[model samples]
Target: MVVPKHGVFTTRENKVYQMKKLLVSAIPALALSIAVGTAQAGETLDAVKAKGFVQCGVSTGLPGFSVADDKGNWGGLDVDVCKAVAAALFGDAGKVKFSPLTAKERFTALQSGEIDMLSRNTTWTLTRDSNLGLNFAGVNYYDGQGFMVSKKLGVKSAMELSGASVCIQAGTTTELNLADYFRANKMEYEPITYDTSDETVKGFEAGRCDVLTSDQSQLYALRIKLSDPNGAMVLPEVISKEPLGPVVRQGDDDWFNIVRWSLNAMLNAEELGVSSKNVDEMKGSSDPNIRRLLGLEGIKGEGLGLADEWAYNIVKQVGNYGEAFERNVGSGSPLKISRGLNALWNNGGIQYAPPIR
Candidate 1:
């Protein structure tokens, strides 16, 4: 993999030259000229383009967001985001290599350039966005941390448990926040920490802990595997903020734009009602915005460094954000998560898209 150039923004021509040289060396001569690259700090865009795929970092086994099948094929909301970026870059959604990562390894994996971007269920906190030398493109899921307790515990409220043992994932804000909530409430509790999501759930199930604390979305996703989902209840107490989204290493404008716009494309597609089932038919509608969006007319594709028909490619290949959500977390999905803050902005939700001009 070619490492992206870093530093304060400097010369555009320098980037082009570096990308060109790298492209010439890495890819076939035919591919060099066509690649529009913004690669490593001083390297050329062509160089990264020649590599022919985006490397995405994601959770190892979150059912609604990331999971690998017995055949090792990965799919979920996060996987679909990767597919959207791939579709934008190559016009083929399959052009990607997914790297499964643990919560502890996700940031380090991105900072070292081991992966290009992370679409895992990472929350955007002040400490992470500003202090960690990373950038969160935007919040895709506005979530909050909560707890799940088995009915056997007979605890109706989070505060009712004065000495509950909790199983929380390590290397996550959830662990720290879990402590803070208990401390501030003056409740005595014991925490069982584990490095992986599965391990944490198992620890809670094995009677090692009385509660499993995590993002409400994750708790819901994990609840299905319980011996009986109805036997466990998520406490109404939501302790901390968890605004999750795609993340990229700092200082790569070209790559950053691609990831940011790829997300925007999905959001905009949903706002325009351009679902896969009807996007093509909407192409002939009189709505000018829809025309521009679906690539039926206008230069929407080229404006984002993608083909003019890029939006069409996305809906055709991976589906819109709403479809991906319903497939992964909504009523149709195993998680059965409600569209709380993730609803469309106009519909009293937070998922607003920038104008696709």
Candidate 2:
């Protein structure tokens, strides 16, 4: 039999000998020590680095939000946020794998660590922020819930849809808001719930519900998916405040800061007139904000535990906030939605970020 050094046995005979010598009462303590050691390994950033990429959670398929083509190529504003994080971490926007999740599963996925971050169109709520052990990085898309109905229904406003069957995604703020909106207005409506947005669209398209309700942005995206896109009309009334943004697990302030600043970097890039098209040129500008943002004069990125050029990578690879919005859901795409509340603070809208200084 081979003897073991330090009483750490390798061979089966030595293991049996050690087991015989060791006290059974100590097994629980030993197991606890192993558990604690495993847990102390590291947090999300270390795990993300070890894996060489960030795992981002996104919608299953919502054009202008997140969608995968036949070749598994992902696109949309939410996808861009994940890409920006990747650019910050790995300097490669393509260094990410998107796990498409439904509204019902998004929170649990983030809570269980199935995803490093959730870039899906999720709303920030008091209950979620205070109870879910998650943090909202920042508002990426400011939206409001609205109703869409076929032109044949002759419904011109949400107030006219009393006792209508509304198709809504289960496990979403939209569902809760729908109830609140109708109750406040002293109206009535039946709800048809589905697990995914696509399913909700399908149910609406199939005439299973008289109306479809969601964020105004989503109503636009889903309207285009209908068989007769022109036949559906989104009501003018904007109900319930929906401030959608990316989310990360709680307990890791470092990772939270990284995600939050990645978005803020994009917002500030737009405000500073730095874009993927001219980011390199803007790096040489005399403006201190531009220089600091582009990593020419400051250590902001390093402060976030990232490369000094982290914001530069995000702007170089992902473009500014306006560019992403216009391309994904604005005039550049089928949605053609105007930048109502999403415009920069200096412009006419409220999309503002803290100074890079």
Q: Which candidate gets the maximum lDDT versus the true structure?
A: 2
Model 1 segments more than 4 A misplaced: 1-48, 296-299
lDDT per residue (tens digit) for residues 213-307 in model 2 = 99999999999998999999999999888999999988788989889999999999999899999998897799999999988886767789898
Deviation in angstroms for 183 in model 2? 1.1
Whole-model lDDT values for every prediction: 0.82, 0.90
TM-score of model number 1: 0.86
lDDT of 1 by residue, 1-357 (tens): 854465354545466767655674765535432332323434212334677887889898998898888999888888898889888888899987999999998987776666778999999888888877688887678899999999887888989977988898989999889888888989999888899988988887788989999999999988887777898889999999898899987776676787787888888989988888998788888988888877767777766677888777888788888899998888888788888889999988889988776
Worst 10 residues of 2 by lDDT: 31-40
lDDT of model 2 at position 178: 94
How far does residue 67 in candidate 1 sit from its true spot (Å)?
0.7
Model 1 whole-model lDDT (C-alpha atoms): 0.82
